[model samples]
Target: MDSQMNAPWSNCSIGYSCVKLFPPPMHTVPHSGEAQHRTSPGVEGRGRMKRGVQHRSNGRSARKTRPGSESGFEVAHDFGPAAESARHFDPARRGYTWGMIRFTLLSFLLAALLLAALTGCSRMRFVVDLVPADDGLTETVVHEDDDARWRSPKVALIDVTGLIADVRRPGLLTRGVNPVAEYVESLRRAEDDSRVKAIIVRINSPGGTVTASDVVYRETVRFRERSGKPVVVLMGDVAASGGYYLACAADRIVAHPTTVTGSIGVIMQTFNFSEGMRRIGIHADAIVSGEKKAAGSPFEPMEPEHRALLQNMVNEFYDNFITTVTTNRTGLSDEQINTITDGRVVTGRQAHELGLIDEVGDLYTAFDTAKELAGLPAARLVKYHRALQHVGSAYAESPTGSSSTQLNLMQLNLDGAAMHDQPNFFYLWDPTIFSAVR
Candidate 1:
């Protein structure tokens, strides 16, 4: 008996019955208003008892207990199916339930009525696109503020805005319009129209490439000679450099009082990154066939010979520009032409005073001047634009619109990379480009 009490297990002998010991079963009494359920004799029942004991040990119960009862069973309140159904059908809630139903029914009925009305129409039409498909150029009549005749003998208003490049000015996603091509097309249209007795070339640009500017100038001169129609240039906000170069082709130049005209010179821009590369311990190993083959290369220092060569070319182009100005502006003497042709920009009033422009006035003054030049008593004003382009008034923006001349480092363009790779000659007047280095 002593061994049996001290040992881990009682010794079994002949004629002696062995019994297994086990912990007493736990019973959780159900709370008031809840049905009693049997607890399974396994891990699940133990888990529940452990949770109840944990709640009691924490000085709290899972639910409210009767006064003096220690059971931690959760109270089953009136949240069952029957209680939910009774609450849903209560008099206080009936109005809200019925209102929701009525609203649903009304919405369905209204939707059906709308569908029926649409089906009863003669045609089922849907507007998928607002822009017209036709992209052809169309003539738009621009009514002037004054009493100008609305019928032909017409004055064709052609706009030359933005960079006057022969190449297309590409956008972020669009294959943009070519200023030269658009100008030529408009000129062709005016030439073909017999009723168009005169042309008013409205210029708003700081200039562009030398070749492009010359192309527009040559075309305008040819158009005037071939069509026998007088061409009058009306300078807008800015018509400088190549803008002024093209204006030289006009029979008479009319600039507004505030217009910025005449930057009559050429510019070839390039940068040298040799010093920067050297500071960073990098060098360009370019193998060229001749000594001057890599002339004006940014990878290396520009030699004195290279500088002279570039300067000679610039002087040649400058002479051509000066000759064009003098030939067209016959009223101005050599001294007067020399004074303003030093790549300086002047206002319209100053330009007129300097004999660079014919008159200082508004669009009306240009109209009167055009009429006088064409020898017409009265003429209608018309503009050529794409079919879908809106032209509500005389000052409506052109299709090839003007862009800010400020240099933007973040702005992306399709041709930007290619344009930067090659050296370009510009007649542009944007001083903001140098700000990047500063």
Candidate 2:
């Protein structure tokens, strides 16, 4: 045979067909929520193969091949079904999801920390902690160790220095430390102690509100009567008006040689900004229920009738003041009381001359007087004292060594003026002290 003719197609060719006896059955690829089928047509007696992939919502896939038909011959022209377009996986999507979770957690943690800081700082802003004078009787000792048996009868000194004002508990945003309540507490302690034979109230104030002075006076009188322990008043640099009123409750009063005393009067005052308001081109309007309801309004001028109404009230308090002074100083004649009852500041010598005080002396002399009144030959002299709320530097004089605390008149007046935005009755030495400091 010739080479080309004798070959007779060594392998299967398009013209010379071959066939298998059996072909596998076709199968459909399974996909979630959907079904897809792939097929390929073939010539007679030739089997074709189809390929398909199942996809999931999670971006995962499985490969599958559909079996050829039940034909004897296999088709040569068939190719696997095109693979489902390869999906590009991005790493940023996973990173973004984790990042969102972290950011939310961090935001919550930061907010909680900020809230805690604010809460703590806000509470600290106006927290007024009061540490009592003598830490509430802890500082005083009646006697030394071996000499305890020989301790003398004690005389407790209660200082009524600075402003004799009422005490108020500290508020969330306002911190006010009060010495009056502490002083009163000290007196009560002295009253209950049998070893304490007497009490001396030392005054160094120019006076304060009428009600506060009366409260101190009343308490002193009650102490004297209840315990039968004499109370002697010792006047220092400035004890007048309300200070004097408290002194009148004492068994005897002793004043230093140049002590300023006796501004026996009541005063009520306020400001009228009508002229200033006009200059500033501002006006005020108030809706009131009655004509006298806005009695002390600073926006308008005070009428004569209003002045009379307030003066009458002041007169009543003055009369009470005069009666108290006269009643306390038993030997003072009405003429003598009237002579010095005017709001006149007097020296200790002049006060002695007018019989306003029992004696002209120093603090030691007053202590001796207290001992004599209480029938004690010698005694331990103790004064109740508080640590200074604010202290001067180490180089400055120690407040503990000082006889009394000096009040900031400007601050006191400003506080009073703003208390109710109205004028108040005072047993103060100088009404102008309540005037604008600047």
Candidate 3:
């Protein structure tokens, strides 16, 4: 008999008839071709142990019989219950994983549908309204309107507020609305509408870039000459410099009694970080094609020649401004023009005295003036407003239906660096306000 065998890992046993064979402990196995027989009382057999024997606590095993035995004999092995339980749990775990995946996918689809419905319901735009007074004068409501306002004569009101910039840098993501584009569109709309008898140019700005101011001024003049209609400027809290430049083109310029008007001049400013950089141990070398190309670079100090060159440009702009004012206010002498256009801000009353503006009046007075100039008894006031959409716009809000109409000072200061990051000239009132806080 071959009696070589491995000991049982667990407690188990196998037998034939009444001949039981219990599992042996480790380290006491018979060698190959050797016999280790334990004879029972009721059976007789010659047996040899095999390589692998195992046991279980329950005394059950996977059974197999040995062939050609003189008396019937067997072998078996058993693993513990821990291994059997793991096999039973696998299907339930697979089902739970798939169920969670389906739930997550369905949630995302529902959320998208809800967002789409809300977006469709929030569409808002503006219409010109005419509220008739008892005295037959039509009160101008430049905001939301019903169908009745369209029946009256209309005067398109275009707002020229906030900083005016000719921002044409390629690939630049502009934060707010472009005043030039918006103003031009309003003019075009007024030009096309036969019902619009006149235009009321509402101005509330401290002015901006030279080119941008000229653009608005030229456009207003051209629109007036081309359409054979009248334009009346209504000055708000502060309409100075380029704001006044736009007003110069109008048939009549009306200002509120407290309005600050006439800061008629040009300005150019640049910062030199050379000394600061030097203290911090930084040096930069420039390779340039021309000596004047980097004239106003903040990285280096401005040269005397560059200063002279820039001053000449400012003078040219100043002359152009003087010419515009003098030509418009035909009664103003050269000395009067020289006295008033000294970059000093004045009250609307002072401006009227200086011949810079026509009258000191309120917005309704401006409407009346526009009506008189256009020869219309009553006209409806129409203001252009941006349509509300899902994406946010950073432009200045219109006067009507808006709670706040002024730019935040802190935000403007923060954007100061970006506004003055490049070299440029301006037709502005105060350039120091846009300097970095430090």
Predicted structure with the largest TM-score when compared to the true one:
1
Could you arrange the candidates by TM-score from highest to lowest?
1, 3, 2
For model 2, the local distance difference test gives: 0.65
Q: Estimate each model's TM-score.
A: 0.66, 0.61, 0.62
Better of 2 and 3 by lDDT: 3
RMSD, one per candidate, in order: 20.5, 18.6, 16.1
lDDT of each: 0.72, 0.65, 0.67
Ranking by lDDT: 1, 3, 2
Q: What is the lDDT of residue 142 in candidate 1?
A: 87
Which should have the higher lDDT, number 1 or number 2?
Answer: 1
The CA lDDT at 400 in model 3 is 23
What is the Å distance of residue 153 in model 3 from its true position? 1.5
Model 1 Cα lDDT, one tens digit per residue, 79-114 = 223333543455646678889999999997776677
The true-versus-predicted C-alpha distance at residue 173 of model 3, in Å, is: 12
